[model samples]
Target: MSTIDAQTDSDATDVASRSNYELIIEPRKGLQLFDWKELVAYRDLFRFLIWRQIKVRYAQSAIGIGWAIIQPLFSMLVFTIIFGNLAKVDSDGAPYALFSLAALLPWTYFSNAITDGVQSLVSEANMLRKIYFPRLMLPLSAVAAKLVDFGIAAVMMVVMMIVFQYPPSIQIVALPLAIIVMLITASGVSVWLTALAVQYRDIKHGMNFLVQLLMYASPVVYAASIIPEKYRLLYAINPMVGVIESFRAAILGTTSIPWDLLGVGFLSGTILLITGLAFFRSKEKIFADVA
Candidate 1:
């Protein structure tokens, strides 16, 4: 009986030790570095989010993806009438319509990225409350979804350029750099804005107003040359200045690639990306709680 009692006591202790385990998961206390390994592990989730955004974007709509082509096309027409015809905005000797369309392509992508991204976190509040996934995925997927729209708009651009009798020059090689800068700027701004919008809620409402204000600040409808030469470098800090101007130079193929503008814009975009990531990570902890 004593041997049996000793064995029973030992068995109870073993089971108790195994059952009394603790696991804690939360955002870190100090500097919060992104966990790349964990994100890679969640790649499937990221891809699914991206696809879901693209599908749901036009699910119940009649025009479907035609909305993509219509947005910039209508904006270009409006700009041509107002700025190109009325104001006589310079177009670097190309048709004003094509010039504005080029800038509008990237600008539209940026605008859509911000408009959707700022809402990404707040819109998914239920998922945030119920599940544990990388919150960064929300904004990233939002930005990526707009690329499909950009692609459709770009095809329209190609057709218009051909109709206008404009052809791209060898300088088209630099087009990819312009696009990369646009993506960097969009991602950085989206991340920062989305992070803040999730917490404050007011940022969500003001995003459209902010984007409208920013469009005028960029070279979307007007040429950067309208600005005094002395202010070019200062103005290039806008990031989109380099992006839009570079797109024109590359796509329109009239001007040589603006290496100087590209350098300043790329540097500014890089700084924005780094600082935005830092801010997003710092605020990551409060998202679940406040959200």
Candidate 2:
């Protein structure tokens, strides 16, 4: 056996035998179990991990942070031409460009976070095999880093709002809640995907295509109003529908709060968050060995 394995086995046995002679410790399923306190103990590493992700994200790109602005800007232009001009998509009385950009702001953040976060653990397998900080930090750091991009994109949205002469509503105060909804949705999916990713490497590429398809399916270019009233609830199951629509309502002052859709999103997002955290904790123990 390897030196580390020998030492670990010895220590585990010694501790168990000392605790109770009559009792036997058995292996548990679900891989690494969740340790809420342990994650908190490594808070410093969490902070550094978040910072490192940010730097690594923008370090060498010629456009640097400008990619954030360009992304939504380009999306808005394309959406305007195709959906606004060609399809004559209804935009709830707001200019199609402004309407689409508001939604794209949050949609971009959610898509990027999971798209990158799912690969965080697998890509850093070498580090995982060596270091002992909480494995959860890797996914969390990936999600956190995407917030920088979200912030830059948000600024661009505000600039466009002004240029387009769209005024904000009193609902603007709820903007942070909309952002939080998108973050929770992204992080929850990240936790599940990151854990499974270590076991299945093909998921990394598959997720990229899946996320792209999801963007077009979402309300990035069109308004929720286009959906017939009968199917609105069914459509909102995407979770992102509510998040994007709510963000647009707050900024553009046109789309009213889609409470029914928001309710579905909030429920789905919360469930996903809990499920992801539980699954991540369960499989954490295998990460160091597998990675």
Candidate 3:
């Protein structure tokens, strides 16, 4: 081979070596889209994020996990006294405490999930600015971590059921559906608010009032049957109305599973979730900047 040709070949090899190790960091092209597959691929990171939240939740607490049962348990007591006794609200023939608790358990989960999930990104601004993971994980994991609280509270529920002699009926088979509805609804609202929260901080302040209004709007303290039949269908559109009522039927067997409510709630939840995901994806590009 000619000397010049040999020299040129070495130069080409050197350039090829440099090219092999090069990494081009550039902006993502065009409009961003939610990558569902990327989320699945990062499942380990998601689990870790959930665990990290769980640790942070109980790290400095004295009662620790007991705090989970406290809220619903106390709420049940208050509602039992106010609605069950004072106003004489009907509990579908179920004991008022059991009646209120069944609703409180799922309701508490939904409320806490939204409260935590909405503020998750803002609370973790440093992490948001420093790293690249699925931004959805922040809200998603915040929701998941609350499952720990839900589980602890559920055990307390089993004890209450035993004391009250309220064995869940065969309709308990439908309880999973109620849980799914709760998750879908909470996640949807949280994602939408978390996305918007990165832009507008006012949501956090109004959230508690909104949650209280939602609780009362549903049959949490009263009977769904008491609502004029004409408005029941529209009332079920609130998402919690169906799930809260379903929790009662599935657990207390006070009434047949309200398939209509489930159908309505599930449909509304799906729309909220799909639209929320779209909004989150569109605004994702600005999260690090705003957060």
Candidate 4:
């Protein structure tokens, strides 16, 4: 073969090989649920996003991450005084401060995750317009960032448990499940709110109201036992009710497993997650234009 012809054949072979390796990007049609492989491929980007969120949150604040510990601690104190002393709310045989703090650990994380996650896409609008990555990463990173705050607040919870002389029990084995429940519930709501916030700026204000209402609706300031048995199942649909209750049961070693309520919470959270993902995916295509 002539050298030119040989080179032409080699170039054609290279073109064929490159075509096989080409990645095609196209607009998704109708409720495409998840892109697991793309998400996995972007794992490094996801990690960086989570880290960036954590650092940016406390970057220039005077108290920095200490806000995490202080916010929940102060809230626990007020609840102890108001609900524990005044209202005479029951804490299921544990100290009110400890009870409230246990619930607050998960509650604070969830609230913060949703509040920040809802705003993540809008806040990162510059990046959204300029770059391409999994839109899920934005809200997911926001929720993941609160885990740092959760960890910090949790240490204070342990300290409170020691002060109250409550030791860890075998039930502590369930703590991971409790945390996972909180994460799922938070992420699910965050996904829904984040997607909505992009199209409706009013959602940001409504979110504040929703979070406050949810706090009261859940058992944050009181015990689940105070909820009527007949209505307890209805209350468990809130997801956080079981999560906060389970936290106290596992950590404070107070109540029983409350399997029925926990089951309701898990089911509700799973449904929220599926629906939220579907909604987020449907709206994701327009994020650049709307965000």
Go through the candidates in order and give the C-alpha RMSD of each one to the true structure: 3.1, 7.5, 3.3, 2.8
Superposed model 3: Cα runs more than 4 Å off: 1-16, 19-33
lDDT of 3 at 151: 94
For model 4, residues 1-291, the per-residue Cα lDDT tens digits are: 999999999999999998899678788776568899999999999999999998888899999989999899999989999999999998888888888998898999999999999999999999999989999999999999898999999889888878878897678888888888888999999999999999999999888899999999999998889888899999899999899999988888888777777889999998898999999998988999998
lDDT of 1 by residue, 204-267 (tens): 8898789999999999998888889898899999889999999999988657777877889999
Q: What is the TM-score of each candidate against the true structure?
A: 0.92, 0.86, 0.91, 0.91
Lowest summed lDDT window (length 10), candidate 3: 27-36
Instruction: State the lDDT at 173 in candidate 1.
Output: 88
Candidate 4 residue-wise lDDT at 262: 82
Ranking of candidates on lDDT, top first: 3, 4, 1, 2
Candidate 4: stretches off by over 4 Å: 1-24, 29-31
Q: lDDT per residue, candidate 3, 1-291, as tens digits?
A: 999999999999999999899677876667554677889999999999999989988899999888898999999999999989999999889999999999999999999999999899999899889989899999999988999999998999899999987788999999999999999999999999999888999998889998998888988898789988899899999888899989999999999999899889999998888899889988888999998
Clash counts for the predictions, in order:
0, 1, 0, 0
Worst 10 residues of 4 by lDDT: 22-31
